[model samples]
Target: MSGALQPPSRSGVRIAGDLYQWLVAWHGCVTVLRDQTLRPANPIVAIGVEADGAGNLDDVIFYRAQPPNSYEQVKYAVDSATPVNEDYLLSPSPTGGPSILAKIAAAWRSLTASGSQVDLALVTNRHPDPGDPLIRDRDSRTQLLLPKAGVHGPRSDRGKARQRWAVGAGVSEQELLELLGVLRFDLGRDPQHLRELVQLLMLAAGLRYEDHAIDAGADWVARMVRDGYKTLSLDLIEKAVQDLDLKQGPARAVLSIATLKPDPVADQADWSLDWTDRFDGATAYSKRRPKAPATWAQLQADIEAAPMFLRGKTDIAVTGSLRQAPAFCTGAAFRMVSGADLAILQRGQVWSTSADYEAATPAIVEHSLGQGPDLAVAIAVATDPTTDILRYLRDQQLSVGSLLVLAPPAGGAKDNSIPDASTANALAVGIRDAVRETVRTAPHVHLFLAGPLGLALLLGHRWNRIRPTTVYEDVATADFYEPAFFIDA
Candidate 1:
C-alpha cells in the first residue's frame, strides 16, 4: 500500500521533511487526551506505536494496558487528489496476505476484549473520498468514510464504498461506524495554513524563537522517534514535562539584525557586507551589561573605535540604547556628533537619525539601470527611522535593473518602536500584491529588503508563497548588503 507513494516536490518542501508525520502523531495524542472518558481516569499508560520493525500499526495512543485507546494510521501525501479508498484498507500484503482493515479489526477486537473503548483515526494530508472522489470540502471527506444512505434502506444495501471494507474485514456496518473516525489535513494547496499548523505545533512544544521554532520542534520529534516510539504523543509530553522541563525555557528577547555591527575582516577588494558579529551592542546598552556604554561620549568613543568600510551606496543606521535604563523608560535621549553617519536606534528621546532625516510615506520608486540581472526591493516601515535607505537606492547606479520601494502610507506614524500586527498585515498584503504585479512584468526579481527584523520575518513568512526570494541583512559600514537567507517557496 505504501510503495505507490510519490516523492515530494523540490520547491515548497517542508523545512524538515518529516515534520508532517510528527504533527500527525501529535494530533492523535491530542485527540485521545481530549476524550473525557479516557482522560479523567489518567489511564493513558503510554501513547506510541509498537516499535516492532514492520511499521504497520502507527500512531498508537494507549490507555491503561493491553490495547490502545486510539490507533491512527498517518499518510502524508503531496498530491491533493490522492484518494482514501476501500482498497487502501482492504488490499492484502503478499507475505502474510493480511490487510490494514484486518489489522484494525484485530486491534478493535483486542481493545473491546480488554473493555476499552476504541478510537481509530485515519489521518492524511489529502481529503478523502470513497464515492465520487473530490478534494474540495468537508462533505466530500465525510463521504469517504461514511457514505449517505439511500431511501430504499441503508447505504450499505445500496453498495456504499465503506460497506465493501466492512465485508472484507468481517465486521458489521455498525461496528465499523463505532470504531472509525476520519481526520483529514488538506495541506497540499494551502502553504500558509501548513506553515501556521507547523508553527502552532512548535509553540505547543514551548519554542518561542520564530526563526528557530521549526528546527527545535523537529529535533523534539526526532528524539521521541529515536527512543523507540514511532510516534510523538502524550509519552513524549510526559518526558518533556519530567526533565525539569528543559523544553520550557524563558523566552529570550528577539534582537533586531540592525542592532549588531558586521564583521570587520572583509578584504578591501570585496565590497559585500556580512553580519558575523555575535552581540547586539544596542541591546547591551539597554541591559546595563558590563562594557556597555553609559554615556553619549562613551558611545561615540565606541563608534569611533568601531571599524568602518567603504560602501557602493547602501545607507546605514545604528539602532539601540546608550545606557542601562528601566524596562519602561523610553524618554532618554542620546546623540553624538561623529565624522561618520551615526544614529541611536531607540524610541523616544534616545531617537536620532542620519542628519536632517524626514519620514516619507508609502511610495514605489523604480529605477531603470539598464536590463541587468540584479533586482532590489527595499522595504521601509515608519517605525524603523531609516526610510532614507529607499532614497539611497533611488540614487545608486549599482547595475540594479529595477528597484521596488515600500514606504509607510502618508500621514502614518514614523519612528514608532513596534509596528502593530494589523498595520503590518495590511502593509504585507499591499507589498505582496505589488510584488505579484511587478513579477509578471519583471521576472527574476532579486530582493534587498531593509526594515525592522520583526517585519522582515513576517515578510519572509508571507513571501515564502512567492518564488525563491533572497533577504539581505544591512551591514552598517559595509559597501554592499549581505545575503542572509533565501525563502524558497
Candidate 2:
C-alpha cells in the first residue's frame, strides 16, 4: 500500500515526519524479501500496517511473507494458518474484504517452499508500556490494538498511553514476517537517505545545526578526502562535480575548502642564505648553507684599497690554532646577589600591575614558602577554593605551621558533614594524638584545622596545651589574613 505522507510542523515533530516520508518512498520496496525465486531465498509479499486501536492505522508494520495461493487444496493443507481459510468451501469475499485463513495458509506454504525465514522487527520512537499484550497470531499476523474505551483516560500521560497501546497488540508469525520484510527493504536502501529526510524535517522545524547535519557534513568531507583528492584544484573541482553531480554554489565551496592547498611561493621564501669569511693560508672561497640565516654587511670600499696579509679570507683555520688564546683579553668578572640584592632589584624594577611579571611575583613567593619543611607538611582544602584565594595565601609568603582546609568536590552537593558532639570528640582525640606525635618528633610545632565546626569545637574545648588553633571558614576568603602563625597575639 502507498500514500502521500505529510511533514510534521510542530516542535519535536521531525522524527515522526521523517519516518512517515521514509515509509512512503519505499512502499514498493516492501516486496524485496518476497521474491522467493531469487538465489538469496527471500520472502514473497511484505506489508506494513499500523493501527491505533481507534480502528485507524497509526503506524506501519513491515513484514515479509510468501506469494498468494493458487489452488484450494494447497490452502486447506496449510495447517499452521492463524485461522483456517474457508474460501475453498465458500465464494470469494467482497473486494478489500478481510483475508481468509486459506489465503494465509497459501502464503505460509509459499514462504516455506522458498526456504526463507520470516524476519520481523519494529521501529518505534516510543516504547510500549509494561503488561502490553503485543499479540501475534500463529501465522505471524500482527495487529496493535489500543486499550478498550475507559481503560486509559485523561489521567494518563503520553508515555502511559503509548504503553497501553503496545500492550493491546496481537501479532501472528505470518504478519510479523510481512512487517519485517517491508522494514528491511525500506531500511536497506541507504541510511544516508533516511538521515537526509530527517534533516530536512529538522530544518523545516527551525532546528538547524542538528547532529544529523553536522555529522553528515563531516562524514561527506572525510569520504571525499579519502577518495584520493589530495589537493583542491580546477581539475579536482571538475572531477568532483562530475562524479558527485553537486550543484555549483554551496556544494562546490565545500569540496573546494576540503581540498585546499597552501601557497608554494610563500613556502619557498621562508628560508634565506648567509655569507661568512673563513681564514686560512691560501685565497679561496667556500659556501655553507644556513637556515633562516642573517645577511652580512656589504664591503663598500674598492678592491684595490683592500690589503691582503698572510692569511686568506676563505682559508679554513686549523683546530689547534683556533683554540689558542687571543693576543689580548679582558679581565675576569664576578658578582654575588642574595635575597636583599633581589629586593633592591625589585624596588628598582618598574612593576606595572598589567604586566605578566607583576602577576608572577606571588607565585614566586609561594614557591619560596613551599620549599620549607613546615609549609610542605601542612594539608589544606577549600570549600570552594578559587584562584584568588590561593593567590592571596601565596602572596603572604609565609611558611605555614601545619594548616588543613576542607572543600567540597567539584559539581557536588555542598552539604558537608558538620562535626557533631561525637564527631567533635573523635576529631579532638585524633588531633591530640597527631599533636603528641609532632611534639615527640619536633617540639613547639603548631597544628591548625580550619573549618566552621572545627573552629567551634577547638574553641569550646579550650585546648591551650595542645597548641592547636581553629580558624573560621571566612578566614579562607579574607585577603587580610596572612598564612603566617601568631604567638598568643
Candidate 3:
C-alpha cells in the first residue's frame, strides 16, 4: 500500500499567454463538439499536416470526429481511394489556409477533441466482426490535391482538360497547426514559470484508445523533430523533464509469505454426503432436541456412532512432509473444506510442528482408519521439506489409484504468495506420477490437490488428464478471482 499513485501532469507546450488563452477557448469548443451531438454528419475533423520539400505539403490527413456514417465514409477514404462528399469532410478548412472563422466553425463542429481516426470510427460500433466487409480489401487509389502551379502544356488560356481533383480544397494549414498543438500537449510540452503539466484530460474523463493517442502524438513529435523544429524553449523542456522525473516515483510495502491448510474435518470426510434427510438422519442423534438437548460431545459422539460405508471402497492415499509444524497446523486446522466431509478424530494427538507432523501424519492416518477404513484418502502436506518422503511413498509402489502428493503453499499466511517455481515443478512432477499410477489401477478415482501449491504441483507435472473439477479457497480474501468468473457467457 506504499506505491505512488501519481495523477497525470500537463507540462508540455510553450506559447504566449494570449495564445494559451486562445487554445483554452478553442479547446472548450472542441470539447463541446466532441461530447454532444451537433452536426448530424462529420461533426468534427482532425487534420494533420506534414510539409515536405518544395513546400509541397505532401501529407494531409483528415479524420471524421463523430457519427458512424461519416466516420465510416472518412475511414473508407483514408484506407482506400473512396471518394467522400465534401459534406462529410471533418477538416476545418479544405483549402489548407488560415481563417479565424473556419477554426471557430470547426470548434463548434465536435465534442471530444483527442482520439485516433480508427478509435473514433470504432465508437460507432463495438464488437464489429473481424470478417466484416469493412475490413476486407478494396481496389482504390490514394491521392491528394496540391495548389495549382504554372501551366504545363500549350494553350494555357485556351482549351484545357479539367483536373479530377483540386488542391487546398480538402485541408488547411491552420487546422493542421491546431492539431499539432493538441498532439504536443498530449506528448508533454509545457510553458515557462509553471508546474509541468501532463494532460490527463482524456484519462480523467475515462476515455479509451490511450495507446492510439500516444502513438499519434509520438509520430507527430518525431515528424516535427525531423523537420528542424528542435528549438524547443528551455523552460518548456525543463518542465517536461521535471514532470517525467516526478512521475517515475518509488514504492514501499511490508511483504511476507506463508503457507496454509484446509480444515481437517471437512477435508478428511471419508464419503461425500449432501446436507439432506439422509445426512440429517445419520447425524440426528447428536442434534439438539426440545425433549433431549444435545451437547457438542453428544453431536460428535453421534457422528461417530453412524455407520461409515467406506468399507471396500477404492482408496487413494496422498502423503508428504512438512517443513514447519506450526504453520502447517495453522493452515490445516482452519482450512475450509469442499466436496468432502472432515471430522477431527483425535485433535489432542495431532502434532502442529513440522518434525512432529511429519512423524505423526502416517500413524495418524493409519490409526484413524481403524479396520483399514476400506480405503484411504490421504493428503500429504509439506513445506519446503525434503522430497525423500515423496520418493519413499513412490517407491512403495502404491497403485496410482491410491496415492496423491501435494506441495505446501509458498507463503506462510500472506496473500498472493505462491510456491517458488522450483518447488512447484517438483510437486507437479510428483502429482502427475501419482495421478497416472492411480488412473491405471482405478480409472474413475477422483484426484485433487489442496492449495495453489497443489494445483501447480499437478500442472507442472503435465497431468493434463487430471484436471481439478473444483477449487477450495482456504483464504477467500487471498485467492485471486479469474476474470472469466465475472464475464457473462
Candidate 4:
C-alpha cells in the first residue's frame, strides 16, 4: 500500500548523517559540562551515541544511570531544498517499511511500552513547508503536532492527516495525542549551523573553540562508536580533552530567570531565579509596586547576590524571561562597568555583549501620563504595552508624569519584526538611550517593557545614569498591577 518512488542509496549521505550524530553527541557533553545542576553529586552519567541495545532513538541520549534520559533521532538530509511536507512524512520510508511519521510513532510506542520516561525528537535539516496544511498544524513553540479539529466532524486536511497517521500507527485519536505529546520535531538545523552551535557551546564551556578541536573530538567519538561503545563518561571526555589538546579556558557561568514560560535554555545554566509561581497575571502583578517594602528588598537581595555569588566568573549566559524591573536589576548586577561579559538568548540565537552591530532602532514616542515623581516608559517592541500600561495605571490610581514609548513599527511589531540579533540589540540600545535622557530628573521611574528577553537583557546591560526604577507586571484578569523588583538605586 505504498508508492513506487525510492531514494537512491548513497554512502556520502550516510557518512554526513554519522558526522552530524557525533556533533550532536559532542554538543550534549559540552552542555552538561557547562551546567552544574545538570550533573549530579553522585555523577553516574554519560552521553550516549548510537546506544547499542536501544534501537529506536539511540542517536543521541542524555543518559543518566537510570530513566528520564532525553532521546533524539537524527534525520539528516544532504539536500534541504524540499521541505518535509505531509507527503514526505506520510510516504513509505526508503527502506520499504511504514510511513516515516508512522514509524516514528511506532518507535515511541515500543520505547514507552516499558513505562520509561522517554522524550523523542526528530532532528532534521529539512524544514516544515508552510504550504502544507499538516505542516501548519505543527506548533513551532512546542514542536508538537496539534491537529485542527472541526465542530461537527474532522477538520478538512490536517484533521484527515492526523486520522491517517493515527490509523497508520495503529493508535486511536487519544493515543495519538499521547504519542504526539512526548514527540517533538526539531527541524531546520543544517550541518553548518549545528557545527557553529557546537563551536559556540564549546567556547562557552571554556573549551578550545576551534574546528580542529572539534575534528579531534569527532574522530575520537567515531572510533568509540565503531568499537561498540554506548555511552561516554566524564572521565573519558576529560581524557579525550587532555589527549586531543582540548584546552580549558576561562569559563562563563550561566543564569536562568523565568516568569511567563520556562526558559528553553535553562538546562545549560548554573544559577537560576525562577519566579514562575508568581506569574498569576491577576492581582496587579503587572502594575503597581508591591505594597510591602520587604518584597522588593528580598527580591533585590537575591538579584544582588547573584553577581557576587558568581563573582570570579568572567562571563555569563543570561537565559529566561525577566519582566522590566527584574531584567534591569539583573543587568545592573552584571553591568558593563563590572567588566563582566554577558550573552542572552533572544528568540533562538545568542546575542552577546561581545558582539556589536549597527542596525535601525525603534522610533521613540513620549506620552504624558500625569504630574508625579514617577516617570513611566514602555518599551513596545513585540506588542504594544500602551493599552495594558494605561489600564494598570488607572486601575491602581498610580501617579505618572510621563510615559515614553519605544515603538518598533509605530503600531506594533509583527512576527518578523525583530528578525535578527542586530535588530534586537538596536532596539535595546534605543530604549536604554531613551531612559538615559528621560530619567535625568525623575526620582522614581515606573518601567513597563513588552519585548523579547534579549532586549530586556541588553537594556539592563547598559542601564546606566537611570533613577531607581520600579518594574510592573500585568496580571491578565486582575486588570491591576503589582510592582515586581525595584531595580537600580
**Which candidate gets the maximum lDDT versus the true structure?**
4
lDDT (Cα, tens digit) per residue for candidate 4, span 102-162: 7777777777788887777888889888787656566554677654422124666756766
Tens digits of per-residue lDDT for model 1 on 1-489? Answer: 778866666554553335665654443343333332223333444456543422344544444443434555555555656465555557786576778677767666654665655555555555445353222223322322333331134443344644665687778866665554432222232333344443332322333324344444445655778776554455565455354233443211111121122211121111222221233344332322223223323332333222333222122222222221111011111111122222222211111122232232355666555645556676655433234444445455444566776666653335462345445445655666677766664435456544443344334434533445554444443334434344443
RMSD of each: 21.1, 32.2, 26.1, 9.2
Model 2 Cα lDDT, one tens digit per residue, 255-354: 0000011111111111111112222122112121111322111211111111122111211000001100000000000001100000000111211111
Off by over 4 Å in 4: 1-12, 35-44, 131-134, 146-158, 256-264, 270-315, 319-330, 336-489
Query: Which sections of candidate 3 miss by over 4 Å?
Result: 1-405, 408-423, 437-443, 448-450, 453-461, 464-489
How many clashing residue pairs appear in each of the predictions shown? 5, 43, 49, 15
Best by TM-score: 4
| Model 1, residue 421: C-alpha shift (Å) | 5.0
Superior candidate under lDDT, 1 versus 4: 4
Deviation of model 3 at 255, angstroms: 32
Q: Is candidate 3 or candidate 4 better by TM-score?
A: 4
C-alpha local distance difference test of each model: 0.42, 0.25, 0.25, 0.70
lDDT of 3 by residue, 1-489 (tens): 579855333332122322332222222222222233223234433333232220211122223444321111111111212222222222333575533223322332342244322211111111222232211111111011111211244234211211111111222444432322222111011221011011222221122213343233334334444566422232332343244232221110100111121111121223222222211122333311111242323322332222233332221111121112111222222222211111111111111111111111111112121221112122334332123323323454333323233333332322233333343334444544554444443323222223343332224224344433121112112221111000000
Residue 72 shift from truth in candidate 2, angstroms: 30
* lDDT for model 1: 0.42
